[model samples]
Structure formats: structure tokens, C-alpha cells
Target: PAASEGLPRPIAGIGRPVTAQEIAGWDVDVRGDGEGLPPGRGSVKEGEELFVQQCASCHGDFGEGLERWPALIGGRGSLNTDQPRRTVGSFWPYAPPVFDYIRRAMPYATPMSLSNEQAYALTAYVLHLNELLPEDAELDAEKLKSIRMPNRDGFVPEARPDTPDEACMSSCRQGRPVAVTMDSRRFVQPGSGSGFSEPQ
Candidate 1:
């Protein structure tokens, strides 16, 4: 006999299996099309208050980022620069991801204690600081995901062919070899016979 046949129908997933009530856990994803947002709302002002108390020590007052810390605003278009660039407004593509990241990891010392209301408020404040939304904007779960970033269109799917083809290597632009004009002897000592020479 099959092992599952002898078990209870509900436990065995046979006919009319038992079901549990779908507990409405906090799965507030808030997609870009304004989905999964809770009914609550918040503004930048309230976010600033929360930020000053919970944040700012590490993130900076203007979101400029403290010593070796993450900046929360600005840097609209400097991704290609040699220096480090940051800001939720510039680097991040989706607002929902920002909210998700913040909810998952934020306030440095403390993690995941901010209520949903406070998270929405802080999200609004960051958006306001980055000029993505107005300071008085009341960010609810619906509107938060719709906010787009400056570099949204900057990325594209990688279209380059994979390796081992050896077709991607460029031409060696350094033209044909020429006579060495510089004296190698002068560069080194008069009688240095060792294979490798040490830098002065």
C-alpha cells in the first residue's frame, strides 16, 4: 500500500485537504504599479523628525553621508566617476526596493524596529531630500513604489557574447616594435648583473 494512503485525508493531501486561515502578515511589497501598499499614509515632515532621532548620526543631517557611510540623497548622475557615488535618489532604480531595503536594514545600530507608518514617512523624507517628491507629499503604500529614480533608464540587459570565442579581443594598437633608444645600463647601476633590478 502507498505510504500516503493510510494517513488522514487532511494530512495526506487526498480529498478536501485542511486549510489554514491566510494570516495577513506584513507582506507590504508595494510594486511600481501601486500594488500591496497598506492604507496608512505619511509625509516628509514626520519622516524628518524620525530621521533626526533615529538616523542622521550616521547618514548625516542633509543625507550627505558620514565618514565611510552611505548617503541617502543627491548624486543624480555620477555613476561612471572614479570617486564613490551614492544616494537612494540616484543609484537605486525602484522605490519599493528602497523601502524594502530600509525595512530590512536601516538606522545602523538598530534594525527592523521602525513601524510601517514610520517606514513610509522615512521613505517620503528620503524621496523629498532627493527631489523625487515634494516635502509635503503623503506617501502611502500605493504611491511609494511608483516613484522612479533618475538612473532608471541608465541600465540595460547585457547583450555581449560569452567568452572562449576569442572574437572580442581588440587589435594591439601599439604599432610594430622599434629600436630601444633609452639606455638600460644607465637606468641601472654600472655592474648590476642580477636579473631583476630594484626601484630606487
Candidate 2:
């Protein structure tokens, strides 16, 4: 009867259910309160070594970031600057995310290859570079939550609305109607049309 029913109406679900071990490997999200962090220990000293070899290139020797690259340290009193450098020390709200992020994605060319202990050590080292943690400090899942960021209070909830409901189709500015002063096409190659030259 099942064979006559056209392969039993085809299976509703195709693949086997994911096992707990598989879930554990992929669902390693570290929460803000340090929940879901794996059990591992690392010291700042250990971090410095790994960072120099694995992280110093893009992030700079002290997490200062290469030219035009993302910096991980400094910028402590720069949130209000004209051009602020939003490094981990300056903008990140928590430390656990740093550890989780580094473990998940880091070293640019390589990702998700650091051992848990290495990740913890790198986290501590980055904090140390930021002047948040002591050079000799150790960080673990339990200790990571206690760390605070310089700009932790830099951001706050804005209860009030930031935009108006009115739809502005035109004339949104207070100044006199601006005139077209310059044409960008003049600066382009073959400014009259497409950049390609016409055939002879």
C-alpha cells in the first residue's frame, strides 16, 4: 500500500535532526553577561605572544590598527572627537563579545582557528593594550564578565523619536535655492558620454 501511494507521499523532512554535539560546536555565542562561554583559562602574558604572531599585522603592535585598518586599542577619550577611532577600548560595550568575536572571526586571513585558551589569552592581551586589564591578569569565562569598557556609558537609550513624520519631497533646507555651480561630467574621461571612445 505504501509503495502504491507514490513513495509514501515523500518524506516530510529530509535530513536527520542535528545532534547536541553539532549544536554545541556552532551555537557558541557568548552572551553579554558571559553566559555560554566555554570553560578555558588564559593569561595576558600568553596573549601577548599569540597576538604578536597572529594579530599584530592588521591590528598593529599594540592593537593600534594598521594604516586605515581597524584598531583594537586606544581611542579611550575619542567618542566626542571630530573623527573618532572606534576601537575595542573606545566603543565596545563589553569584553565577552570581544572574546567571542575573536574566536569566531579574526586574524583576517584565518578565522575560527584559535583554541579556546588562545582566544581568552588574545582577549586579555587586547584589553591590556587598551589599558583596561593588567599585564599579568588572567581571564576566564567567569572573569571576563567583570571587565568594563571605557565607553560603556557612552551610549544610552534614546526614548524620544529622532525623525519627523512629515514627508519632505523638496525644499528641505532654510538657505536660498542653490544653483548648479559645477558639472562633475567635465572631470570624467570622454565627459560627453560613456567613458569608451567611439570607433573611427
Candidate 3:
């Protein structure tokens, strides 16, 4: 008899393979173009109610945000200011991701607890708070994708050499590079020849 005949199979039967249903449950991501959005619809009014119940504690009743929490509304036209207030209306370039974020991680204390319809409603209510949607508006995957964000055109392709789109190893600059250096002797103490002085 072969020595291998007495040994157990090489495959370890510790855990079972993941089922398709499990994969579907974990693959709940909505794309920017509205792909993968679950079949559901939610009205702004419904969303308002859901937001008040599930989101108002941290995000405030109108999405202004409580202490230390981020605001979801306003900040429109403030991106160019010294104290820029980045919010959903001022910074987000797409709308579908909003629903995706709310669905996956929201209400802080209990994430992924809300149903798809509830997520949609909360998204609609947030849009309403941003003044992007009417109080009577209803949001589904189709309408959500159609609604353009205020900063839809705000993002541009990165031009830096370190970025993937413009990565380069040599000759990246348009002109001669200038070297910036500080005088090390200036940092030395007057009585100490080589030792550097501590900053006051």
C-alpha cells in the first residue's frame, strides 16, 4: 500500500465556500452612474421623517450637524473661501454615492440597519435640506442619478506627477528646478560651534 493512501486529503474542510446569496448581500454598492441601486423609491416627506428619527441626533434636524459632527447641507459657494465649509451640497460631485454611503454606514450608532427604502428616503431628505430637491419630490434610482450635484464639475483630473494619471520618473517639470535650502549655521548657537540651538 502507498504511504499517501493512509493520509487524509490535502483540502482542509474547515469552512464552507461562500454562497451566491451571501455575496449578493455583501455586494450592495451603488455606483456613481446609478448601477447596483436596489429597487425602491422614497419621497422627500418620508425621508424627512426618517432623518429626524435616525439621523437628527448627530446631523441635526436640518442637516446642519451637531457638535463635532459634519454638516450635510449648506456650504454652497464656500469652497473658494479661507474657511471653506465642505458639505454634501458644496463638495460631493455625485448623488448616487450619497445613498450608497447612507445605506452602508449611517446613523452612527447603528449602521446598515436601515432598509433600502429608508436609505433612499434619508438621501432624499438630505437633498431637500441642501435645497436641491422639492419637498414633494420622490427619489428612485433613476431620479437620483438624474439629479446633478452642485459641484458636479468641481473635480478635475489631477495634474501632479505623483498621480496615476500623470506619473513620471524624469523630466516632469517645464523649467529648471530651483533648490530651497536654509542656512544651518544660523540655527547654531553663538557659543556652541557645532551644536544646534533649540527653538524658543
**How good is model 2 by TM-score?**
0.76
Task: Show model 1 residue runs off by greater than 4 Å.
Answer: 1-23, 26-34, 162-164, 167-200
Across 84-182, the per-residue lDDT of candidate 2 in tens digits comes to 878888899888999989998987779989999999999999989988889899999888989877777778887688777898777776667878898
Top candidate when judged by lDDT against the true structure: 3
84-131: candidate 3 lDDT, tens digit per residue: 888989999999999999999887888989899998889999999998
Candidate 1: C-alpha lDDT: 0.75
Better of 2 and 3 by TM-score: 2
**How does each model score on lDDT?**
0.75, 0.86, 0.89
RMSD per candidate (Å) reads 10.5, 8.2, 10.4
Worst 10 residues of 3 by lDDT: 191-200
Worst 10 residues of 2 by lDDT: 187-196
Q: Model 2's lDDT to the true fold?
A: 0.86
lDDT of 3 at 8: 77
Candidate 3: list runs displaced more than 4 Å: 1-18, 162-200
Query: What TM-score would you give candidate 1 relative to the actual structure?
Result: 0.66
Q: Give the TM-score ranking, best first.
A: 2, 3, 1
Decide which is better by lDDT, 2 or 3: 3
- Looking at model 2, the pairs that clash are none
